[model samples]
Target: NWRSRIVFLLKTNSSKPMLHLIGNRPSADAVNQWAESLDKLLNGTTVFSIFLKSEFCKENIEFWTACEDFKMLTSRKARASKASNIYEEFIKSEAPQEINLDLHIRNDIIENLQEPATTSFLAAQVKIYSLMENNSYPRFIHSNLYKKLCAAARQEVKYNKS
Candidate 1:
């Protein structure tokens, strides 16, 4: 029932305005930036995130984003705390949002948790990033969502000029 509800929401909202989906009219350049790299794509908009949710793989990006935020922490205490949270959420077996990772990488992360540095999740993050870049990114670029976004962006450009 909950899964059906989520599907209904996604379907119902799919036809809503671009602003509702992405918060602003994403420029053609912004859409192009997404194609260039995963970092640019994640930093640029939430539409890709929506797409990932539709594909039922949003956790990959979520974990990646969390890792990025985790890297920016300067305080060791903060880093340690975040490291535990991240591991619990995305690294530990049966985690709520467990990511697909190699056993060795996962084991390494578990060991690192004893100290919990900023880079504790770096290796796992990179693995997930590679999976998204090589797999999800290409599909997203070709999806109807991306096509509609591009069309919306082009329309915005035209409207701006006229």
Candidate 2:
């Protein structure tokens, strides 16, 4: 029934579909392919971001991405400054976008921040990654936003073929 409803909507929806493009018109297979891995999902497009934001867990991905960027710094000073900013923003207690982390891990990160290295946030980043991979990602795979994206992708494929 729900599947039929989606089909009907896809059929009757205006020529201007509410499509969120990730590069060229993505295939339905591309959307489905992301379900295989968290990295794929994150690297795929803004669809995951849109879904996560809708679920009020956008900070999870934000923190994860920040950690990734933090890992790329070659300069000690830049790494230290970036690490402090990351801690204040996401790891510190009462931070603006404080992520859910174990007290021990949080304390460990605080200690590491004294001489922050590119790997300083590795553990906390892993924890956040697990949280998203296990929790929000599953929900995202089933969300209306994900479904709409797949449907729109299919529609676009059809439109392009004609």
Candidate 3:
């Protein structure tokens, strides 16, 4: 039933790219062609900076340290609290960080990959930032860029441990 549902969804969801391979049918070439087309369209374009705010780690301090590049604003609970000082303090402390072009490639890989993939994609953010800094570009981020960054970040976080 789930496989049928996935097939039906893929058939109907033309807006989203098809998974290419399903069951025994091979889809590598089709997927590769589509990916090449997408690559041409997005070349030289950067999505910009992303502000990360996730509920995944909750209050775990280790998670906080790992994501030091992100401005760890308030906890999710603080946002929902009766008094939001904790959230306010968190925001006040966060230094700005931005997304770099690495996000675009990681997303492309995840979208085209057949098997479940890991979250090592997030490491791209660090690598890209380093590249930008080496090239002498100032670090700047924007809110809208988070969509791709979050997708790649979530994917990396999802597959990293395994």
Candidate 4:
């Protein structure tokens, strides 16, 4: 009967749109796609950040998020200052948490910082995104931490229904 009831709900629910009442349950595919899931997993929730921090890659997500936010600045003055801050903190050699990037990317960012427009971080951000997508994201999908979070979400939903 539980299976029958579930099937019944699926069939009947089509009559009225079914909204996702629970939150943060990203699908397996979403976990792999960059733009679709990275923001919510990395920036929107503490779970992913906490796990990343433990594994020593939190800086990657933080830098990526800062780049995205920095891109949204409308004022030239704001963009310039933020660009300088990002370069000093994330791009410079011997910085506290220097990201691994190609020399060409670093040099391009250096050149862009001369003017420091909104798009100054574009090339560097792409490189970082690719790094995470190719390297970190797969580990994230398979990590025990992510599995625990998914289990916790399921438990929460089950408990809420009772």
TM agreement with the true structure for every prediction: 0.84, 0.81, 0.18, 0.72
Q: State, as a TM-score between 0 and 1, how close model 3 is to the true structure.
A: 0.18
Best by lDDT: 1
**Maximum-TM-score candidate:** 1
TM-score of 2: 0.81
lDDT of 1 by residue, 98-153 (tens): 99999999999989887887788888888998999999999988876666667667
Superposition error at 7 for model 4 (Å)? 39
Backbone clashes under 3 angstroms, per model: 0, 0, 3, 0
lDDT of each: 0.79, 0.78, 0.31, 0.66
lDDT of 2 by residue, 54-157 (tens): 67898999999999999999988999899999999998889999999999989989998878987789889999999999999899887666667777777777
The alpha-carbon lDDT assigned to residue 39 of candidate 4 equals 51
Model 3 spans > 4 angstroms off: 1-71, 77-99, 103-122, 137-162
The true-versus-predicted C-alpha distance at residue 141 of model 1, in Å, is 0.3
Between which residue pairs do clashes occur in model 1? none
Model 2 misplaced stretches (Cα beyond 4 Å): 1-17, 20-29
Full candidate order by lDDT, most accurate first = 1, 2, 4, 3
The CA lDDT at 125 in model 1 is 87
Candidate order by TM-score, highest to lowest? Answer: 1, 2, 4, 3
The runs of at least 3 residues in candidate 1 whose Cα sits more than 4 Å from the true structure, single-residue gaps closed, are 1-23
Q: After superposition, how far is residue 130 of candidate 2 from its true place, in Å?
A: 0.6
